[model samples]
Target: MGDKPIKQYRKSRPRAEELYSRALESLAGGVGHDLRRGHPLPLYISRAAGSRKWDEDGREYIDYGMGNAALLLGHAPPEVCRAMGDALELGFHFGNDHPMQLEWAELIQKLVPCAERMRFVNSGSEGSMLALRVARAFTGKTRVLRFEGHFSGWHDGVGKGAMIPFDKPVSAGIPPAVLDTIEVIPADLDSVAEVLEKDRDIAAVMLEPSGASWGTGPLTVAFNEGLRDLTRNHGVLLVYDEVITGFRYAPGGYQEYAGITPDLSFHGKIVAGGMPGGVLAGRADIMEVFDYTGDAHRDRYERVHHLGTFNANPVSTAAGIATLKRVATGLPHERANRLARQLRQGMDSILREEGVAGYAYGDVSIFHVYLEAFPGSGASDRERLVTRDVNVLKGIPAPVVSAFQKMLLARGIDLVSYTGGVTSSAHTDEDIALTLDAFGDVIRALVRERVIATLK
Candidate 1:
């Protein structure tokens, strides 16, 4: 609610800014990922605990971004930290299998019924890449289908259309041949079916159950169920990319919520316990393609490789196991869901009271606030809400939206500037109230500025 606008964020977080400058000399875009860049230069974090992050300049803010939806249990929860500490005492990596990996895999299998067999990887991209490889190998097909907006990961094969223009390719170095193998389909079932029918070479259909790329757009349960049946009948593997939704949605993930089981699933985020880990799990028969102990594989074990040096490293495995165990018994999801509902309700109520031409909607722990030219009463109306016309929300002509983000940032609220916010388990009732208050103040300010007119 400060009337003063944030013209620029300080570059005084010298360490991060300096590191970014140095990185630009060797790294592309001065950052590891393009999404890391935000207005006023991304603040360099010094440390984080629970629901808050302290930047290098000592500014503390309530973090709803949660490491891009990775920290479900919040940052460095005591149990996960303790487990990682114990594992570190035993050493970080090993030449072969470890008890921690098995323990984590077992826990995943127990919780996710579709995961009859599981393999850990270093990150979600790796997990997704390996899953595609396995699917292609198992099904003898070359093409993979994915929705236009959802992001699978950063691997060349699955990275297309992520942050791309109108869900087109955003990166430059990728070869056209590599992009062709990926079939981008609309979320509509008929469109998917049409593509499947036309392209018989598709090995699998990979999708995020929640439609997360557009900020927690919940897919209809029937749509998911229909896709499951379609893929099964067509002999195409159904891969649920649960990287963001896995533990955050529920203990069983979106698969459980939709009451549909995919042939293969990828997991990251919550599964990693804020470290770095990923998992691919599915039917034992389909996953057997990864096994190397068969008669024809005695010598091929070394040749037929699907391995990473840091895959299932002891520390990450321990952290994952501990985090899952804790989440299984706690109220993290319930707390997050309650907070999400509270935030959405408060935003909606404010919009109505202020006669703002916009609305907010989403699932339990995640939601999106769309500042549209007109209000959407339901899903049918949502289709008419185009991103192009939402200039007031985007604030392209001036730094209105960007300035609003900085205002919120200055007020100690951490939200993904490009997208809507997320709710974490560490968020408290007071935190929810404060966020709603901040949101109301911003909306009122926008109204005063004539950026958004009264609904009436």
Candidate 2:
């Protein structure tokens, strides 16, 4: 153990605790999403600005969660909020087509490499579901090949391998037959080939281009391009579920960064300017499967139907239009990525200096912090991490993560979970320094408390 005494870090946020207690009476676990459920209590955010937010007890925090990576410009960006407000005055849903949607779609087509055709959906979840349906209809295939631990959405089919143990459904409602239609495997070319060869009826191969769990499990650019080529040669449609990477990785997103175009892609999160909406964009010919006036050979079951009551609605489209216009120059992504690089570098320096067991790793603008140190393993430790069946592999113990998160909150920093965090254009260099400083303290505390170790 270290010479220092363990610091009992705790924030005075009793109001948050009370609210969570009250919420538990009405809401399940006092939270909406499963991820928000906490060990002690959930944080009740009062207000948020560019890079900071206040909890119920008026505790200000430097927020790294950034709306779960949906806020590239940061929370309540005035420009986006003004646009949304104006659109709200106009109305949300219209029985007929609106002009603002044209601006939104046109901006997307102008930037995204695979936006030859596009359709609006209510959320990233809807976007993923529609992408699969279109692929099935266009290819007449009955199954999908997905990478293990890649999250498409919370839907029954593509949601299987994301966070739950491998091959286990995310929820209880999905049937066995629904899961049997999709195949999950480790992220490798041989596995891809084996799955394709074994299952001729596979409709599409889908993945998060940035890698599973937002690059906690990183993927190589060569492998991404190889998948495109492999799928095309095998007549299997390739789909990039870029719900997290869209508008964050680059101006044109991951497809532009990798220069490997897929047949389809799903976009959400930052695309709607911190609002609720998503997109299904890709090859026009294949997307025509959603059209009614298709070829004569197209049968009823072969035609894909997609409809959203709020699809292309004014508020989201207006916010999207404003956000795309502001971000089209690519300055936001560049700034966020620059900040991310700085944060990662600083974090790595601390880990090394402190002789911590784990490392910091990620792609352009995304990063994750792994606490479980595997001694005698170098970067290969990260490579080895991906091969494990995630259902059975618990990376860092949840309790340790939760304690770290609470400590971060006490220190006026908030992240999505124990590991990685999303950077934003609004985050200043000072914010990066503060986060790094807090991380160093937290790591040292964990060491003193016997939660983390200093490798000899």
Candidate 3:
């Protein structure tokens, strides 16, 4: 393998490197999304079709990030694209109401378990933000309880306890005062009970239903069962932020898949067919804040005034309708999860056979690769693989993950921030095999570099 020699990553990407240098002056970190940052240079994708994409340098890659989990059907899927194109020919924005919005919501309500009456928003962050506002207004409570490592979105209210230390906000812009409105706690059921009992004013319990950040730290069905009962008994609105899981896990998402319904839910990702849209859906009674027909200012706060420039725009909704129509059959879930299982199984087996002290695991289609052992983690390989420790993964040096990413690139696979990625219904058996073969190469490279120690 060493004699064969790995492809040197960037031998032909002068244009991309030049563009990154220019982009640095404009785009902070030379990338739009923070996770898009990379060493050497970010792979500037020119175009993508099906499961493969070509970067600016003309290097083809098997994309596992799948547009940050928004592309459940894969890049430039024909149906979604055609719907979006037809929408474009008609109009991109109406600014007023349109028929497509109702069609989109109806499809969502048909699929999502908790979706009764829903309002569209531009992004998942906005959906989660609105969900919390509705929960607070309905319950007449001041604070929200969210589990550590659970990412509801990039909004200020659900900011802490995700992609950052539980005690602090995800970024500095969030006012310290805002933290008072939110309480971040462990995901343990007893801890949840204690917090709910101690803080009677908690309006809702919000979390990513499939677990933190697409199951980097997976949750069991039993935990959700207890959580459902606890939240119900405590009178706290339960909100499932299914940004990455809503249409991907099953036609009805995690709530249906897990059989634990929530009071409210926010959906994005595949719900919008990778287009910029999201929705806040829930039981009709609690979602009444968005409906100001009877009166306004019924409580401490004014009626939930929710408006977005792109809310339920025709293009996004049309694409969403097409995407959800396909997801309704549950075949996408079957295909993507099967591919992921193959990828995860192969990668896990490689860690053992190649003697690397790491593991790969995820819920359904989403998967993660941990190059280091979980800290304070004496749990079995299986348990630790799904362990809920975010801070340590956050603390790993950038270069180690960068090396892993770069090496994987040399073998033609792309993962987001080297954390992990997801499979799409479009990802083929050949794609899975290619991914596993690439993983084999990268693991050897990491072992050679001592980025990952050999399994004892």
How do the residues 1-456 of candidate 2 rate in per-residue lDDT, one tens digit apiece? 122312221235568667877897998657998878765567788899999998878878999899888888988889999999998888777856799888899999998999999999988989989988888888888898888778888998675777646677878888899988878888889888887887889999989887887776777899898898889889999999888888888878898888888899989988888789899999999887778765656646667866678888788889899888877898998899999899988888887787776667777778777776323234423334333333323356776677678677778888865577888889999999999899889888877776764555
Candidate 2 TM-score to native: 0.92
Write candidate 1's Cα lDDT for 334-415 as tens digits: 8889998998899888877776666677786886766632222233343344342222233332344455566677778877
lDDT of 3 by residue, 145-203 (tens): 88778888887887688866677888878988788888887778999999999999999
Model 3: residues >4 Å from true position, as ranges? Answer: 1-11, 294-302, 373-397
Cα shift from native, residue 259, model 3 (Å):
1.0
**Candidate closest to the true structure, highest TM-score:** 3
Which of the two, 1 or 2, has more TM-score? Answer: 2
Q: Which pairs clash in model 3?
A: 355-455
Query: What's the TM-score of each model vs. the native?
Result: 0.89, 0.92, 0.93
Model 2 spans > 4 angstroms off: 1-11, 294-301, 373-394
Worst lDDT run of 10 residues, candidate 1, spans 388-397
Ranking by TM-score: 3, 2, 1
